[model samples]
Target: MRPLDPDDPRSVETAGRAYRVLARIGSGGMGVVYLGRSAGGRAVAIKMVHPEFAADPEFRDRFAREAGLARTVGGGFTAAVIDADPEAEIPWLVTEYLPSVSVRDAVHSSGPLAADAVWDLAAGIAEALVSIHGEGVVHRDLNPANVLLTADGPRVIDFGIARAIEASSVSRPGARAGAAGFMSPEQAAGDAVGTAGDVFSFGSTLVFAATGREPFGEGPWHVRMRRVQSEAPDLDGVEGDLRALIESCMERDPERRPTAAELAERLTGRAGASAEGAGAAGEGGMASLPPAVTAEIARRRTAAENPPVPRPRLEPPAPLAPLPSSPQPWPAGPGRYAPHSTMDPAQARRPRTPLIAAAAFVALLITIGIPGGLWFTVRDTGGGVEAAPSAGPTPTASAAPASPSPTGIRGELTFTIEGSGRVSSLTYMFNGKTTKLTKVRLPWEKTLQIPSWPPRIPWKLSYTCPPGGSSDSVAVDGNVIIRGQGSSGTNMRSEGVL
Candidate 1:
């Protein structure tokens, strides 16, 4: 991973700090997170306040307060804030980077986990919520992205949108668009949020994981809003303990939903009983048992292999071996004696001597011609060639008609210039060196074709427009360079010169 670009609006700069940024891990409304490493090689997730919010001093102060509150609720299911600098240019806070997949990605890629995994996820989230609520913080945004599925359990992330119940106001300008399908009715209505909102969001997330669908309507923002505010969440496909638990969490009345502690206990009890039943079943089936996961293998093999869908841990096998190197001679009659056929060293040396001498004579002549060859080349160019010795430089070879000699090449290039501007010529440059084009013509609107060219080299194309307007981009073979002027100006050009 490379360190996030400091100039990138999504990247946070903590220069002179002990840690070095590795790469951007994720971003949310409040800030972007970077996976970074300390001088001591410890992996940490660094979140810097979005510059838009950092401009507001009040938001920074609130972030600092919330960060302190977040630090207090460290436990099994929450990412604990390790360090923070709320006063930096891009106020950044660091946390532990638990190597895990987000709930959204897990469900989307693998479809969904089994019932056991879902139960574990629900219990972990409930326990984490209890700690968060105990510390006077309410996670206003608890969507699938914030819920991470790790080996230990699910861990909740992103508390920038969280509210402290003690504060008089938690809402900021457009605060957070708390996930559409997960927001509680109060949150959707822009009313005050309580612990129940977190529970509701968590339940909605679980429902999404179970069914691979949102609990509310999809499409435009207005439609989703209508569903969140008025429609009852459909828990039709939800089964097991999840059905009852989700129902309680998503109850319209906040008072009717169970507390975080209560939900955690219920889910934990279900998990324990399920584990006991699984173990008992295993014991009872011992007499008629098959190999571990053997039935699963048979079931999968019986189905069609969907090629378009990537199957991890699987690749086509290697090809067969080639034919033998040489043909074997037929066996002689009963091992009859034969004359010795091995060649003497002197005989082998005699044949190679003349060839070696001829090669030496040729090499000597080539060595002698080196200086003469250089002089001829310089003389042909009028001795105007200069050798500054740089990475790349434009060739000043004299223009000539296209020939099969491979000295220079010319071809038609269609330029698709997007912009409301007039293009003069498409100039080609090698590396950072500029090429002086002698002739130019527009083959099409925003397209240019040049003739009598030079040999193809690693190069890029730049476009020039009237009134000194220029387009930025360099492409190989100058096939597709878009050029244009104005904010929405786009131009596609093709140039062939080598």
Candidate 2:
């Protein structure tokens, strides 16, 4: 059926008395959206099935079944289904009137949303999908056009084409109930799809929200459909956490994609993060976006209004009482509170006597400098070197033969040389102590330096490589010294500065 212009009066009277048609809001393949009022004076968007579909009993039944399932999946993230008439001459469904622009309008008019807003949008849509999917229904037509941006949050709409998990494939011939650039690859291929298909669509919606570009690229509807299956999204321009997320969603393999709940959690992690790129282009010189686009939206809205109803007024209340004075102040934000007991005393006023005593006790032992605090100081000693507690540190010098060097370092720094490498004999001395390493590798073991010596004493290691080896050196300061043959014809040298 041809789209009836909203300017035409006949379109307003097409639906039955179930709703009082006000003005046409929009139109699509399944239905025309009209701003209407219920018998109780509640505003709603009455979606009447197109005349072509209304004439077919099979299509009408499927539309009604899908809408009914959508209503059962109640959630704040979705527009609430108010009423519907499956037996009417023109089947129509009414949903709570959402006085906000669809995501398509927001992007086309105000440009793409900021990173924070984009994440929030993704979260809201994902939450709605979670609810829809929980009811065993798949919103097979998720797209930017079906998402509305309101003051409260983004809302998912138009479940006229949703499919129940157990629903049969008895849809009408021309009823391809999804946006061209937003459909998943599986959906485009006419294969049985599951929740992952919705995830793919959600990813495409994010691509639109992030860069004002469709994930599957753009062209004629058919050409765009072909791209969804045959091409990948060019994510070079999109930034922030969304880049990886969109990549995961748009991956050719559906099994690897995250579920709606998983996507919601991921997006929640990214909310309020800083945005980059052309997404922040708002109105006004200081606005985060361009003004021309917002103005166009406002103008379109004004033209669409029937008689321009007055904005609602909310009255301010009386002044609030003054807060009480107290020594204790309120905790700020989440997980913040004052200590209230010995387990967690206020750090400022807590006594440190115990800590001081503990420190003094340990320091006194160190100062005495004996293997034990005092040898035979106890009054009940048997006269000789009565065995002190086993915990006492035994003087190893007395226990073993006294050698010139008490302790020596011994550890192999095995370097795994990559790409035709070898290690030659290396020798270095530091503070009169000699060390040697042999048969290292190219690009790894050209020089060795022991850095534990006294100040200003430089030690060197001589190793050989196949003529051309690494000859680069960087000064690094540390207590334990090390130097080695380095990369690609450069002197491998590093100084440890303690």
Candidate 3:
């Protein structure tokens, strides 16, 4: 038997049979998906509903209806339902696992699909929607993320929020179900949704696949919603028949939009023609996909077959050592330099016989006589005093200034980025404010002067590099030195006091 994934707890089981959860494949508002193997050793994608939602009868009913609808949607483009248990403590459903990457990831990693590949993708998704709508189910959520690109073709997998066309509400009040940029205008406006809403979402998804951006433009949720409801979709880079088809699908009035079956017919160039021979023709048309698309599909398949190894857990760091103590001042004495008059009473009352006698002897020697300007020097050695002859002129004793030294403290904040790509941007956050640094060349070093304050002033530094690279915030205090290493996609960081 294959070993259970240590990273995922094995507390969950479906229908009294244990499924070794290999890893968490995806998650969304409704539930979490896990990559697992059945008792019979079949790979499956298991979606378990959130515990909080399982307690609500309304949500449970909706979940059961979604599973029933999904079971009815049978096609080559849809993942078949393997097993499900909606009445369980945490209702769960399982489907055949497809080793593929989502359309969003494919476009993000390899840029937009070529024109021909976009056509193939559109055809596949439209066909899936046909099978889905035939079962009287509306896939309320159909964004690029829900469409998986596989070697054979694309598959529409996540039906968590799918509801029957006759259902009272798409979702509970105050809760929006679909993605922002792809939701239909009617759906965004909280109006009754229908199969046409999915068609609108399909058109938006195609726009993203063709241009590597959202059709309605990206921003805050309200802005995207406003654009979807009022503004024309930004389809600048889209071209040709596909563009026209997308425009037709995005009609402002739901009644004017064509059905999913009609879209599939149009995409496969079989409009107004018999349904026979359409599948063969569609297959033949997609057989000649662009080399880039083929390579990306192959790459995705390989990745799915061999998912990345989980990183090891890091141990807690050791505690820091304490700082050293400051030095203390020395005691006072008498001679030419007598004890300060402000000395403590206890110390001042102590006898000064030896010191007084020495002072008197020096005074007698100076007064009783000596020739040629004799010189004498007295030094305090902690235990007693010592006298020595001076070779040069005797130095005069001067009083120390009654103030601390006049020195200013300053420091430098140095950032050394050792990546291969050029730095695109850098910013530092301190004292509730953020400061952006000028872009610098690769393998760069820059320094900013910092005025002295407290010994430790907390700071957070962030950096970004060209061609998609970013460093996690490097947090430190006082004078900081940051070192960043690695190429565009994989960067590491280190910090030290300057």
lDDT per residue for candidate 1 within 16-39, as digits (tens), equals 556666564544434556676666
* Candidate achieving the largest lDDT: 3
lDDT of 3 by residue, 1-498 (tens): 122233344435655877666655654445557777788877788877655566667767877778877887877777778777778887888888876767877787778887766777887888889888899888888888789866566788765454421131322233356667888999878688889999999999999988999998854454566798999999898887878999999999999999998988676753222122223323432334445656766664465466555433333233222211221233445434434335578866888776667656544433332234445545554434444444656433222222222233333444444435566666665534567767666555444544333222344555655555532212112111122223464434232221
| Winner by TM-score | 3
Can you tell me which runs of candidate 2 are displaced by over 4 Å? Answer: 1-17, 160-175, 272-498
Ranking the candidates on TM-score from highest down gives: 3, 1, 2
What digit string (tens of lDDT, one per residue) describes model 2 on residues 126-234? 7788888888888787888788765456678875454421132222222244666788898766577788988898888888887888876754444565688898875
Better of 2 and 3 by lDDT: 3
TM-score per candidate, in order?
Answer: 0.53, 0.52, 0.56
Off by over 4 Å in 1: 1-3, 6-17, 160-176, 272-498
Q: Return the candidate ranking by lDDT, descending.
A: 3, 2, 1
Question: What TM-score would you give candidate 2 relative to the actual structure?
Answer: 0.52
C-alpha RMSD between model 1 and the true structure: 19.2
lDDT of 3 at 16: 85
Query: In model 2, what is the error at residue 73, expressed in angstroms?
Result: 2.1
